[model samples]
Target: MKRHAVPAGAMLAFFLTLTGWPQCASAATPDGAALSALWGLPFAGVLLSIAVFPLIAPAFWHHHFGKVAAAWALAFLVPFAFFFGANVAFGTLVHALLEEYVPFIVLLTALYTVAGGICVRGNLQGTPRLNTGILALGTLIASIMGTTGAAMLLIRPLLRANGNRQHVVHVVVFFIFLVANAGGSLSPLGDPPLFLGFLQGVSFFWTTVHLALPMLFVCVVLLGGFYALDSYYFYRREEARSRFVESTPDSASFGIDGTVNFVLLAAVIALVLMSGLWKPGVEFDVFGTHVALQNVVRDVALIAVTLLSLVLTPRAARAGNDFNWAPIEEVAKLFAGIFVTIAPVIVILRAGEGGAFAGIVHLVNTPSGEPHDAMYFWATGLLSSFLDNAPTYLVFFNLAGGEAQKLMTTGATTLAAISAGAVFMGANSYIGNAPNFMVKAIAESRGVRMPSFFAYLGWSSAVLLPLFVVTGWLFF
Candidate 1:
């Protein structure tokens, strides 16, 4: 034990050095109000890299995307550390990792792991009705087990069921629209943004009550659109379809395997709920960023659950599901760069009327300072489409007075609009939500030709934009 201690200490030192941990106690963030829009170039570069590299250099991106992400992160960090001092850079880095990115990736990884363990074993085939049914079911449970969990659990089976289809991109796109984004609008547990609202004193049921109508509206529209589109393609395929052999045995029937993972999934949900509900009033400061005790416990316990699922899950279940770490790995690597690069953007947004995006902040208000529910929906949504929806939700939440009670009562409409935008518009792009990318990656790995980033944007713009306009006019 004593001999191992020295090597462990050395490894810890190496890690701290590698991560550039702050050596000073003072942890200062950038002054968002003083910063220029030029600081956002790296973020733009990251987005462009994600959007373009796949099209022009698919092999390069497949191999060196992580390096590209690291390069962009350093593009921000090197300049930031040089201008703002290492203390500030390291401070913000610690804050982003410990407070935001770590917990986020941890939760996602846990969901991916546990869901991977539970394979729906049996013979299944994709018809328009069956596909729509699966989408509807996933959307319904998304609010219960989270979009990430439900997406991970159901995407594989859906892909397998439709493995024979040549034109299945629209199916995955609608999956993103419904199961990955719009479906999560009904509860805090369903999405990150609403959960942030919950932490800010918004009642747990507030979203469920206010956003239910908008959720149903968008989901019904998207699902119906998907059914029509799928039916058209299905019938079209039938006219010239191949006589492909059925993959599964006829004796097999539809049923679930790895039942224990359902319990593990419940445990995951319980841990998340507990972190939000249990207030231990304890915290640890890592380089001036305060880390709460309950969150720490929750993240740690989630890691344990991830490991437990791996160990306890039946081998056949995972094998049948074709579960691998590639999708989660893609998400983890890409989002690390995203979270880091978006740090300055979040700070600037947090600065409100004084920040670089003052016009954006002001867009949510009327001339008389009253909250504009329509603008709130569009603003929060448009930004959320390009930014992390959780912090985007927080930015607008604070912009709208940051008072949960008032937002729930007097500003209820505004709050509802904000919630609806953050959750629903996350379907607008592949990078809009974590699950969107994960779903895309999983679908692509399973041989589905997902749309490119801009193509997906085109799909959402065509499918979702008009509905949002209607929703805003009708409800906001």
Candidate 2:
């Protein structure tokens, strides 16, 4: 793609191009109403999802079009606005200046293609009481496969594995916690926020060591708690399974066809890191002019990886394995819907409570005057469950890194809250994280209906919320 210029005049003009411009005037975003302006795109996306998905999906989904649409719209609309905006030279380049990490992540995770790479299925004749085991397995996949891939690949089986229960909503809620968001905390490949850190001078190793502990702690608690719920539900479903004792779980297995794809994904990570670690603040101008080299390189890498993956991954393997473009298609369509619908509200927020809305970020205070590293670990996480975790994480991540103070908070604590919050609480609602929608889709295709968006959040408030608070207290 050719490069474009961001004239000095366009900076102000760009702000004016936005629909609502006053809400975030006093915010710490440093971008005036820029981020506030883009909020409308995702809101538009929500409306589009409702209008379209119902018209297209088969009769099987008639009962759930409403819940599914709400969830899908939330998933796509949030990220869509960011990614769609990033494609612009001015938008991405300017955004990078905030911390220089977010655009790095946006370019690297392209996320579109990663949605198809991982999955798991249960063997026939197996008792689904093994659901707890599967959830643990899904957690590992979240780090390795990326949440989109892991969720798309494993969600069906998880629903089926837990098929016999009545109170399965709690099970799905914990799945969102451990499988969708918390499990994805360790690697940039795991969740978008951490991926931003990777693109910023943050080390992958540091993330695993520092960030992994808190996420693991939360996952463990949820797994333990969910397993109890799963057990109770299993009692309800025993009769159902007994009636179908001949029930053979459709068998499922895992393999990448070649280890090359994993290696390539690693290469993408390396290239993204190199821009941050070695090149530090370079953006590719493409033309003779000097712009940030990393921006160009990151986007180029994303496009290249996406195309090459499509070409090299063998079409037959994808088809024979039941891999299809439908999932990604759904993301694109639903996100488009979100982008259009949410455009207005984003402007309103920018014009309204935009400034004070930043109360979300707070550095932890410890008596020793050292960083309370676990703060982001818990805070970003807790809010991520309720708020749009991506921006919520960013709001806090940005806040945490304020000028060094004599106070107990420090950079370490700031980073912790950013990482923890971004990854942990994103599981709080079906709308909390992206993979949540995919899991819902996969489950619906399998005839297992997920809870409504608000209903799922209710489950989160009841189960995962208390569990997260405890984990947050213990760890952060």
Stretches of candidate 1 off by over 4 Å are 1-23, 196-203, 236-250, 388-391, 401-410
Candidate 1: tens digits of C-alpha lDDT, residues 362-422: 6787777788899999998987887757767877887787889999999999999899999
lDDT of 1 at 425: 92
RMSD, one per candidate, in order: 5.2, 8.4
Instruction: Go through the candidates in order and give the clash count of each.
Output: 0, 41
Count clashing residue pairs in model 1.
0
The superposed Cα distance between candidate 2 and the true structure at residue 265, in angstroms, equals: 3.7
* Tens digit per residue, CA lDDT, model 2, 380-437: 6665564445545544544444322311134664576667767777777655666676
C-alpha RMSD between model 2 and the true structure:
8.4
Model 1, residue 346: distance off in Å is: 2.3
